[model samples]
Target: MSKVTGDAFNFSLLKRVMAYVKPYRATFVWSVLLTLLLAAIAPVRPMLVGFTLDQHILKGNYTGLVNITILMLVLLVFQTAFQYAHTLLTNKLGQSAIKDLRINVFNHITKLRLKFFDKTPIGQLITRTVSDLETIADIFSEGLIAMIGDLLQVIVITSIMFYMDWKLTLAVLVPMPLLIIATRIFQKAIKVAFQEVRVEVANLNTFLQEHISGIAIIQYFAREEQEYKKFEKINVRYRDANIRSNWYYSIFFPVVELISAMSLGLLIWYGSKTILNNPTIEPGIITTFIMFINMLFRPIRELADKFNTLQMGMVGAERVFKVLDTQEQTEDIGTLAPQKLTGNISFKHVWFSYDQDQEAAPKYVLKDISFEVASGQTVALVGATGAGKSSTINILNRFYEIQKGSIAIDGVAIKDYQLAYLRKNIATVLQDVFLFSDTIFNNITLNNPEISFDEVVDAAKKVGAHGFIERLPGGYHYNVMERGATLSAGQAQLISFIRALVYKPAILVLDEATSSVDTETELIIQNAIDKLMEDRTSIVIAHRLSTIQKADLIIVLDKGEIKEKGTHQQLLKLDGYYKRLYDLQFSSVGIAK
Candidate 1:
């Protein structure tokens, strides 16, 4: 917690960090004041000891010696107290500022568009938010202010040594150049080492996060040994970077100690000779010079390390600010917040591309796709993989913007509605149902206070999930564990259906929602969908053609374009893409139109 101010720092980044520090400026100011007090008091002790040895001890004035001893003890107590306050206040200031920063980082991350996440590694973001911020915390606790205090202490001690005996002080400082050279080399090496360590740590975090999440796939494919080898490589790189940083520390500290010992030896050797030749040079001054040299060298010994801490904080600040400055969040400029909508939907010649940033001709995923679904009808989308079936759903909910055309609901453009409002009204259940690690009830309600427990029960019963849920030990309160690990695939899918039902969305979307369920569970889900879509406009995507045979309309997509649209019987009669897809899906069961 020594003064940590002497190193090169990015003032621009420091200014940004100062914004968070503004709230705690008073505490910060107090901590600075304590650092100054500690620095001023640190040099006073040796001078007092020198004074006691000269006037009191040499004169054999026993009472004055006792008084001076008590006075020095009081000064020691004050220095210790000031140091305690300085440590407490600086650490408090750091944690308080970092807490606000962590909040802002999390908020920005949550608001960023999903597209940003697609390109970014989750582990890198994690490092920026958690590990980097912790390092930045050290900038305050062990860095800038403490560095300043050390610099001031060095100056004060050096000044006093010169005032007492300039020649001895000059002789002792002949070794300063060596320490400086060593410190500069150590600083440069350690800074690069720290950067490497940070990079390697981020890589390790990314590797671990992805591997752990996909551990099932790895094990199922029998690639554990290969994965372990890959992990070992990453782990070794991280270890090497840390070892390099530690090596610099190992070299630097011992060099400081050796140079300091040389300086002290020079001090004693010169001072003893000077006093032996000249009676005017006090023996007591030698003792004070010894104390001064040690005190002065202490901060010098540690200043380079503190400067590196500040530099790392700036580096960390740069990364965190970059995320905060990202402007790719989903646009929510629309002010309309309707309580409900009729869910009459229309897509007029819509086009979209996943790679919107490409300068080359954009590869459109959905090409001039147009469709309509009345307020109370179900429109099933039939297509092969990458045929733009789900792209329609993405555009409808505004997960991605279309390059052309418009999507409207109840004759109002979807973009005219507030983004959150539009999304809340359109509930989509994907093939991969994600449930949080929480009680089943919380997962269903998503911890919304407005949705009562009775509503959840009703939804679960409608989906035919209540029987199985109640049979569990804690029933609705059963802990699902992470990503619903404690629940079967069918059970998780059923819970998602119940969740969708309780929300009571105006427009329901089922994108292969029953793909994970067994035959019996799929049938139960089909019945649940029948009831759920009774009065709601619905869009369905399924590979199983039988599931959507009774839909009001079935739209077939091929290679990013709509090929046909009609009822099941009508599409079969057309003898086109829908007819072929339907035949292919049902041919395995010995049934085809």
Candidate 2:
């Protein structure tokens, strides 16, 4: 968010932006040719006017005047045609390039590790993908190609001016230095303002996205007025940033107009004296010079604004490339893409930390944790909040890498197997279920071609969800809406269970999956889970001791380290951490332990 003071006409960033244009180079080349044609044809009009005035108009030659007029009309037609084609080509090329860039950004984001998402805001990423990249499209359509055309027009106009009469051209050029100084100062000030504007835009997007998504909480807490004031603060900053940038434009444009007027006055004063003193200098030359001044100053005036457009484009490019350049992706270098895996998992003296800075003294969330689950075995993780229960499941699924030791499935290192293959074989059912704004069937199969509709129905039936699902309006095709808002919490949990069931994963990880349901729903889920555990190696994280009483092994954790490990009866006999937890839970619920 720091103000960018560097040169806005950044070549390196420009080059990166052009790499996407390689596929559309043919259109780019055609656009450039048209631009050149328009520039070459521009000065011809004024020259023809001067020619007709001096050669035909002055002598009263009607036939010659008619011929010159016809030629001028033809030139105008060609210029218009070239302009139309140039605009079409540049716009076409701009859209095609940005489409590819947008896809690339989306692809990159999908592959990024969960750790990156844990730290970055979703809103900032949305701005980079949608709005910021949209600004870059202007670089091709309105900024780069258009600026080139304007610059060539200015150069050609200036050349023609000096060719006709060098002294008059020199007189007209006297005011340009002042304008140049003003332009430089304006560019510096505007770049800073534009950066501020961009920063505020991101902030506003983040605020709106967050508040809207959590509007229920805000309303429930009765914080609408407070939230509105916060939004007002951000909106005010956005307004001020835009106004500041506009203020720069307002001042700079008037100064340019004034400089243009001064050049016109200088031209008329000098030309009038010369025409009076010297009879050889024709009136037509003054008229042509006037047109040249207009031609020259118009582009010069527009060039500043277009330069601003180009700068805004570059600013967007800088932000986008920053996302593209991030290397925080989980390196899927393992070539082994195994088709099937046994339900055996092992963690050997594993150490992990979410803190990415290795140089600093690392704060590990899981310390020297070691465990094992054989094929068709059920292991439950029991702990209070922040005791690294979820961390265990996350690391087992390779969502985050461990700092020390190795994780393996069926004696093969987890990293040695392909990332997609490993993840597909391990299904996770989180406590808070997340369903897409899609049909029930799509959410169940997740669009997996291998899983047929029959398979979805069978999976749902096994989880006791088919009866309720068929009772709904659309049955399996019913729209769950966003995050399953159309369904009850227990219904959503059942759907998630069905989702995991169809995957037929070798390893199943449930993070407090049954802790949020009513007694009847829990009984239904527990029965389904019992059937599921007969084949798959299940890892369950739960605070409820009763739900995991039948697990083959319960590993109790406190402050990240293993405090106790045994079966329910064996741990009770030990009179240790597990028995204390069991007592505490039963006491809270008025059950005599």
Candidate 3:
């Protein structure tokens, strides 16, 4: 994985991130009003301190001091109440915004086509969904609170300072420009450093995930040491990224503190000199000036830290929006229309390739090919690796579109049908079967919610899965781990077959269904499949020719072109590609049996 960079934070990302706040406008407005009230009330404390200094301390007016002190206490109570309300409002608004963003990103991901999943790493996607989202929540909650409150407090303190004495106010803010420049510099460095940190974290997650999933193969091959070395390289980069982030924060805080301290010192010196020369400048006013400076600098200090966090959040926002911005594979024009298609399928003069740069690559994964399967007939596609068997199946299923020519299902153009409608009518069992981490019943029924429990069990029985499921500790209630890691590959395949059986689609596509199973398991799966295919139109993509011997038609592919097409007996008589593949797999079995 490549390192994440600061350029990921584009203007478009910010625009999208801001869009989440629109729904929570009422909550945000209340939060802002409360925050402004708190800011307006903040200056009262310093004014009260000044009153005590002049009336009680300087003049020694005890009777007046008591009233003034009580008023100050009352204002403090109001300030505390405003703070409580502000916190509640902002927290409510922030959390609601996060919920909206999370839902939007999730919904977008689900709508994306299979091709996006093929290219994007699962770990990176998970990072965007979980960790990055949490970071954005922090930015919305704490970062927004700090930034908005700081700016408002600064404005309030400045107004109060100018009212006390304009000359001293200008002097105090002499260091403001320097502070802004310094903050800008820190922000630039922090953005770059945090981007590095994000990259390292994503890389670490991907590395760990890959290694854990492949642990069995790594151990069997005795490649543990090699994998360990590889992990160390990524771990070291993560460490370095973290250290760099720490370094940025470390330098930034001290410089910001120094600037704040220097400003206060300059303000104190200038205010005292002005008061000494002009006796009308009461000691109370000086006290208030010092108090205002303190309050002002605190938020300023917080602003520096909050700004850094916001920059990091922008990086996260960019990653999430990138996924949202991806183009969906194709528009569904069918609108879930019911076509009630017959089983007949036709591939007309089809030429296909996956490459976008077709001119330079000039590589057609499937050259001109045409075939037809009549309703309820079985067509077997057999070939060596990269011979376009799976490609043909994918095209027929509308998983992809061909470069030239058309595919028609029951005389209707496949493109005219919605993806959901097309897929709903077709069931495919791939060599690699994926089962969710759910109960056996859910896995078989795919948690349709509409499919009843009895129907699921019936489907399982048809696929021979019910027999072993009954042997499990919980029978149909047995829970499968992620990707069915708890079961053997053959068992997973059986469960997949049962899932297809339950759907009972009109057209069934089996891509090497029995290729990975042992002889006994193969027989169980084959028997179940034979029963499942009794009336449905079935297309089987197989390497072992015996599996397709019963097929009404077998189309043999060689180097992206069909070299032979006929029944098993007819192909044997032709003495071509089909006969050769048949000889390789089942010739010995034929003699032994």
Candidate 4:
């Protein structure tokens, strides 16, 4: 998780966030104008009441009182209109700015390299894009613009009060310094509290998303109680964080209210004495001052609350900017535009390590690896669990950069080709197949409108998936729920094969693609694989010895280095690592007949 600074306010972050609002500058300017209009109008009603009380009521003039009442009514109508416009414009500006920010975050996320996702949790990114952005929107709708309006109201109300009677204004303002100090304390304390709240929110989301996605594993191992306990601990931390934020609110608001009451008390005590001593001091003036004091202190109180919103939004902006500022993005500097690739792949002295940041020593997962496969040939990689077989495929796809040496295709470096074009030419089918919550046809084509329905159907039929797919209720249109939970493991793998075939890739890769299917289904998949392998470069990673027995070449890897490479019969004759691995499988399973 990215850490945010403890500073209560960040002007740099504010400036960056304000840039998003630049597109809606006209609406924001109009909102500010409406806020000024509202502040100016707010003090009029109290002044009218004081004038009517002193001039009309005291003199018992009915016509004069009625005229004053009509004027107050007009001010009320204008105030209401301005208030409505301000609310609407501020909300529109907030929402519009958030929309642009969300799109940019998503686009940046897609451009990031695989290593970033490997370390960062999916839920944390979701929170940044969704929940955190919404909080930022609150800064515009309820925080920044709203705070400015409150400040304007306070300033306007205070100006009017001092103009009316400077002595009473001083009396009303005596308690204000204490209010300001208390508010400053609250701001600092609540900023820290909200940062904790955001951290816990991201943690809770990460834990919940992880467990929810792996619910099957928990249930399979009967670890429900253990997992529940873990979740309970995270939930408690989230609750405690929120409670601390509430504690600040609980203490701060009442303190503000107490100071407001004290100011009112002082006004009444002093105003009564002044009126008693001087007969010229109108009673209506005291009444007007009381209204003015409420208007002034009310905005001050609301401003404290809006300050909290602003702090939380700044924290969100900081986290969001951290992602946007990441330097680990995949650099797509390749300019090659080859109309056709010959499908020849070569690796020379390749070395890689997933733990690139290790200070002591980075452990290489693949070391001094070298191999080559001609166009239209089949090569199989056989290795134990930590033997770097998958790392080879990952590097070939340029998902991760190699620490040393180079991987090339058709005598040109892999990085020389555009990233999108390189991946498009190399189709991959992993052991674990993933399908989105959409129709089967869309899942196969990945909603690519360019691939017609006939093309999808032809791909499925070629891979022997047409029989099972046609049996589905909606056939190709059948909706596979989340992760294709509705389909069997064999069925999902078949969809993956169809997806790869639809693209007609120049190179096809099967990373234990048939390991999860039953024998009957494996036979169907094997026949399809045989057909797909014809006239195309293919790479197979398999634990099952029978699957790669007929490969043109088999490479055996041990601890990140190639131990042996040859045809299966030749490797058997040498009695090397590949032969031993083949023996371990065949001797135990009676040759997988």
Candidate 5:
């Protein structure tokens, strides 16, 4: 198993990985010294027995035998103590290394821009952080330590055997070449099996997470049977991979055992012939030779087990490294603040496409257009479905970068400002409201933990959520379930509005924040928005033209460009896209202006 082939056993990877252990070098050294001590004592028992058989038992000297027995017992006690200490220190070192790695991985992941999450699946990321890290811990605690011990034991035992009787050692080693060849073959199979098992496990995890999260969707669509079939397919693949691994592992042991048994038989057959032919060969010497035979083969069996674990760990390492190596969407290491100017945003000669492959003659989700939202004013973006309205808002957040032209926040290029600093200043109320499974008060005061309960009550009242929250069983302490699933859509939207308003950010972006509520609730929120946008930069994306009629400016988007732009009254007079949208809406409402 030590002969693992191909890229899995890359020496460069191991050398690169050694740097992670530098912090715990002192602990590592102690572990190595303990391992060497343990291996050195492997042949002591046989030596003690030989001493007893020669100088005491054979000559009927019970006193010498008794003294030697007591010494051997003391040595055993010391060996056990050292073994326990070795495990404790190694475990401490391994856990510390894992903690450091987890911290680095999480910090890097959170620093990544929003676009990274859009492209990567949540399940894959979770697997790297949890399962993959556990595998690495296993490598350190079990595989790595065992491999070190086995190597030392093999070398030390071979040296002692050669010193005791070189001819006997050579005879015992006759079957070793065949054993090594078999191990080499088994190692390749083991690596392939373990790699497959790791991948299948990842797939199973991904499938489970996705299905569980979307179970309601499946039930709503009455596709439960279809989802079950899909899940079964993934589960079957996982089972097949496990079975394949078991097949490889089952063959591994028997082949190794057969070779070991054959080698021992040969050793016994050869050593006994020598003893029979030469009366000068002491019974004690023969007994020691047989004991050494047992010691020599133990390390070989352990080496195979350690190598199998190392191969499994390498498979997990490959998956984990994939995450650590991912390039973040936006990485502005420069510490630059936004420049001063009017809060006017413009898309100059702006052309954008979400897909890069179709860049040439790309389906412009947003076309070459120019528009501006003035400082301290509400700008409403109105468009039909698939008219690039959401994409436009996404670009404003820099969730996706524009391929052509540029987006400026407060008349300064978005790229110039640090992403963390930019996001900190912009507050958003998304169409799909998301709430953590926490108290309503906690969700409202997400960033401002120091915010007084009075402040939370004020924000909630502003958004008209305080009335319902106060009526709940536990008022502010009512525990929301995952995503606040128990709350009605309108209630969730109200909570989201309160969350965004409590932050009191410089820039506010609300996408259909009032869509879920009735006309009465909408009017209440409209009053709240009127107060909230008094001196703040606000952009509202709404389908109901009535909800945004009071905007300082309104831009109508078609495909990916601005088709019309003006104040609500001015756009109604254009008799263009905005007029058509307004007429269609009012016509549905059976109202005429």
Candidate 6:
């Protein structure tokens, strides 16, 4: 949602982008050398034609004219060869640089803290990595390298014109100051236009991505017409931004052509007047000066267009660098590298909130919360919606940092353990399980080559998912489409359980893991849960109290505070919030016997 605003020619951003080009420096150097050679060769044909006209053909020397023509043909071949080499080398250089840059952006994004993703739209990040990177490739393939060649061509042509005749050259350059002013104005306008175009493009992609992912919900609610209208508005904005950019181009090219024609006319007018007075200026010199003027202005015209390419590329580079420069990365300062944890967790005097800022009023999700789970015990968290049950689990996994608290595992602060090592010891299964669009076997192993096929089958069999998976077309190799759409909700949940079990973590966290399963599946999952929880710390957030009745301890939460703590039977005798919740559930659906 952030707008990109910067100068059209940003040297700092250019230097940063060029750093990516440095790795393929050898190829880039070859491309630049080819560009210069092409520029040097470009003027030879016109110069040769002028020489042939003044010295050979006009004097009726047939052999001399034939030799000049053959030389011109040879120069053409060399020019063609140089152009081909330049194109091939620059393209290879551009692609290699973009490949490295794209990887760097993706790597940086992975290192960013969860909070960064919480606020940033996934579509914006996609645009930064994909489309914006393509624009940067244009800088090498179509913009920067070509612009350099154009610059050299312009300089060479201008020098050749002065050598031929200074007076005519001065006359041809008379319109230059006006052309420069016009170009500057065009650059400023197009820069703003391109920025608007990029902003609208990002907005459109964000809107489309969100709507497509939630299309099922939209159709279920019968809001198709409403969603379509919203999309139309976004599409119109994107179209209008592009039209504005085209409007600038529509005016720019003709103005350049008019200036070029006027300069050519001035050159002819001055040559005619000088010829009458001196009688020494040859027609071929006039012819060659005209060709030189065209060569010079042609680059000028093309440079305007290439400069726009350069500006757009700079805009993309600026956006990409912003993401790369972000400081919202997870801190990995801990040195502790334990092979396995003892699964003892303690949250002492924890005061926490999602937002931790000095100026904002504190909105704590957990306050004065203190609890401990022994090395091998099942602790269940039961609470009403928005009662901090899920937040407690999130903190234990260290998904978000806690503001005022010390969360320790095996007597060491959670922050004192290496982040990756800490996470590897904890496995979680959420109510809404997500599976990648991969074979069931790969999904279970998460593409980890270390996890053998036998290990996966054993994990699934233990979780009671193996029977259903074997009935499928490909058994373990069945490809579950995006989000595992081919699998039922209960089946998906079972696969998630299998995934967690295969990891053999020191701690397991389940958030409403069985809330979607039927009675039969729930029983099967419960049996698996019992086996999975043995000799490991387990945390459960359960809506179905029956599923957690045998937990070693049950902690009842109300409005971010613990209101009751006991065994299920002990809590019932206490007749507190837990008992009330239990009775209400039993009265509505009867207790599962």
User: Where in model 2 is the C-alpha error above 4 Å?
Assistant: 1-4, 61-70, 587-593
Clashing pairs in 3: none
**Model 2 weakest lDDT span, ten residues long:** 1-10
What is candidate 1's lDDT per residue for 483-531, written digit by digit as tens?
Answer: 9998899999999998888888999999999999899999999888888
| Candidate 3 C-alpha lDDT tens digits along 117-183 | 7777778887888778877776666776658878999998898789878988888888888878877
By the lDDT metric, which is better: model 1 or model 5?
1
lDDT of 4 by residue, 303-396 (tens): 9889889888988998898989988876789988588887999999999998877576879999999999999888999889999999999999
lDDT of 6 at 549: 87
| TM-score of every candidate relative to the true structure | 0.95, 0.95, 0.93, 0.96, 0.93, 0.97
Give the candidate number with the greatest TM-score: 6
Q: Model 6, range 153-261, lDDT digits (tens) per residue?
A: 9999988888878878899999999899888888889888988888888888898888898999999999999999999998999999999999998998889889999
Q: Which scores greater on lDDT, model 1 or model 3?
A: 1
Model 3 alpha-carbon drift over 4 Å, by segment: 1-12, 61-74, 544-546, 591-593
**Tens digits of lDDT, candidate 5, 140-193:** 777788688878878887887799788888888888998788778777777787
What TM-score does candidate 3 get on C-alpha atoms? 0.93
Candidate 5 runs further than 4 Å off: 1-8, 338-342, 357-363, 447-454
Q: In model 3, what lDDT does residue 271 have?
A: 78
Q: Which should have the higher TM-score, number 1 or number 3?
A: 1
Model 5 clash pairs are: 365-560, 366-560, 367-560
Give model 2 RMSD, 1 decimal: 2.1
Candidate 1 TM-score over all chains jointly: 0.95
In model 1, state the lDDT of residue 348: 97
Candidate 4: stretches off by over 4 Å: 1-8, 358-360
